[model samples]
Target: MCLIHFQYGEHPIFQLIVVANRDEIYDRPAEPAHFWEDEPEILAGRDLLEMGTWLGISKNGRFAALTNFRDPSLPKRPRSRGEIVRNFLKESVHPSEFIDELAKMKDCYGGFNVIVGDQNRLMHYNNIFDEKNEIFPGVHSVSNHTLNTPWPKVVKGKKRMVEYLKNNPGQVDIDELFEIVMDREIAPDEELPDTGVGLEMERNLSPAFIQLPHYGTRCSTVLLIDRVGNVTFVERTFNSGHFKFEKSFRFKIQK
Candidate 1:
């Protein structure tokens, strides 16, 4: 996932609420979100080329999402970062242990920021900075850089999400959440982060929702988990820059 806005243990009814967009090249082959046939417990969209995923959740209440850290100077790692989320969901390990292991192998993969959790707790880990953080009850976000780095879209989107949740306190409105993820407004030039990507490319990727000729947001997903351990996952997919299909599923976490 390229952009993510999530609240944990903040709202009265919801334990965790997430709104995220996954960006990639339009031609990259990927299957829409679904429960894997081999592992019915896992629900996520698969990256066909790598046989991994950017985000996924398991029936046991395990959740994971990954984002790449933008840095042009670093050499690409041999391993695919998507496996970070895939391995987390496939295993039954605690988030803390999983993060510890990831930290040890940080140099094996490209720069990345990852979030892993279950019904009980959430953990954030980044390989680029070699740090591990515990997620407390509150609002947080992570994009191409560090988590909550105050990028324009991250700030605006977090505020919008807070307002949305406040207005609709106990309920999760899929449409409104989608609206927040679909925002395409570009940030002012001064507010854009210089990630080594040129000014033109930086502007292109500034919005909460991104659209480029060949590379853009491929899917948007909203994950909601209530106090009772029920989960609602929804994913809207796009084709060659056009809306293609949407898939949603609901399941109660086995306690």
Candidate 2:
């Protein structure tokens, strides 16, 4: 996932709301979000090459998402960062415990930011910076760096999310959340972050929805969990900068 905006425990009716986009090369084979056949409790998009997931939720209210840090100077780790989400979903450990354990062996994976939680609470952990935060829930965004790092797209998306929820009090227009993730407007050069990637690459990645010659956003995922333990997950897939199809799932949080 490249850009993610989520609010937990901030609204009257909703417990958790998330809007995220997964950006990758056009040809990376991936399975759209679904209940994994082998692990029926998990619902998420599959990274076929790595046999892992970028984001997902379990039938019992467990949720997790992963994003890679934007530093090429870092060495490649033996493990795929995507496994962080997959392992969190597959395990029954408390969110904080899971993150604490990972922190002890953080160097096994490349720089990454991951969020894991249930309806009870949310936690943010990054191996690159050796940081773990208990998210308190107004509105938060994370990208290819730390959580709420003030990157152009992260700032813009979080602001839009706060406004969207405020404007549409008591109800969430799922499609509107999709609109936020679909934004392709590149940020003004002055607002772009210099992450060591040259100016051209930075500009290319400045937009919430990235579109490049051979690589771009593959899917946008919107997940809403209500206070009553109901979940609505929607994923829209794209190809060559065009909308392809959408897959949605609605289930009650078992826990």
Candidate 3:
């Protein structure tokens, strides 16, 4: 997913709330969110190349999101996309510690942006350019940039998300949050990073259409991690040809 809008410890009741969009090519192979029969602890879209995901949670209430870094300048590094998510689910490391370990590797494992957090803190790391930043306790949006610094889509999306959150500050469910991320109405004159998947044509064909059979936002996910170590996850997949939601899954995290 290219963008993640999250609120951690915002409400007195809920612990964590996140809305994300998984952007990728139209032809990549992937299955909707499902538990792997062999690896039951993991829950997300299976087998996506250039796919971003909200990885499985740990027993200790840790949450992580992995997205590709959009830097074409960096040399390719050796790292498996699935392995990154697997490691997050398998380990109990803090966000800072996890980022520290990622920074030591200079092998350029493709461009990646990882956000990991819990009830108390949030950390974001960009491996493409070797940059890292932390978000204080507040409503924030992370795109392909480092925080909010006027990167066209990032700036415009952040403003739109904040405005939505301000107006609808009530306890939001997963679907409501997904609507905010799937919003593609605001078109800026600035250029966007080319995904080589022909998003322009897709957008032109269907502005509100999510082309599932070929390309577009393949998945919309919302993850809620409560204070008591309970994690709730929901994912929806769009139809490839019709751009309508085809399937969905809702489940909780168990050891």
Candidate 4:
């Protein structure tokens, strides 16, 4: 997922609320969100090219999502960052412990930012900043940059999420959450963050929703974990920048 805006452990009824968009090359083959035949306990979309995932959750409450660090000039790496999330979801290791493992081979992959844990606890790790952090409750975000870097979409999405939660108390509207991330408004030139992708390319990716000739948002996902440990995951996928099919799954934490 490229842009992730969330309220983690700050809602009255929900422990974690996430709205994100997965941006990628439209031609990359991928399966919509589903339980894997091999790993039925795990639920997530599959990246067919790498056989990994950008975001996923396990029956035992393990959760993970990843965003590539937006640096096009870096040397090509031998590893696919999708495995970062897929590996975490498949294993039972604590996020803190996984950091120790990732630190050893971080250079093998391109720069990436990942958050992993359950509803009650979480950690953020990025090879670019090369830092690990325990996530505190409240509104936060991450795009192609570090966590909470205040990119236009990140800041805007966070604000909208906070507003949505505040306005609708005691309820989590899945559709509204999805709508928040559907914002197609592009960031003004001055408000854009320079990620070395140049002004034109930056502008193309500035919106919370993005559509380019080849590279654009492939799916928008909203994951909600409530105080009672109920989990909801929804994925809306697009075909060549148009709506394709959507998948929604709801289940209680197996913990």
- Candidate 4 structure lDDT: 0.90
Q: Model 3: per-residue lDDT, tens digit, 90-186?
A: 5778778888887887254667777776667888877756778887765666665555434445555556656765666665555666666666553
**lDDT agreement of model 3 with the native:** 0.62
User: Over the full model, what C-alpha lDDT does candidate 1 score relative to the true structure?
Assistant: 0.91
**Residue 222 Cα positional deviation in candidate 3, in Å, after optimal superposition:** 1.4
Q: In model 3, what is the error at residue 10, expressed in angstroms?
A: 2.4
Best by lDDT: 2
Distance from true position, residue 246, model 4, in Å?
Answer: 1.5
- Mark the regions of model 2 whose C-alpha exceeds 4 Å error after superposition: none
Residue 253's lDDT in candidate 2: 82
TM-score of each: 0.98, 0.98, 0.77, 0.98
Consecutive 10-residue window with the lowest summed lDDT within model 2: 164-173
Deviation of model 2 at 197, angstroms: 1.1
lDDT for 126 in candidate 4 is 93
lDDT of each: 0.91, 0.92, 0.62, 0.90
Give the worst 10-residue stretch by lDDT in candidate 1: 237-246
The weakest ten consecutive residues by lDDT in model 4 span 238-247
Number of clashes found in candidate 1:
0
Count backbone clashes in candidate 4: 0
Q: What is the descending TM-score order?
A: 2, 1, 4, 3
lDDT of 2 by residue, 73-93 (tens): 888889888889999999999
State, as a TM-score between 0 and 1, how close model 3 is to the true structure: 0.77
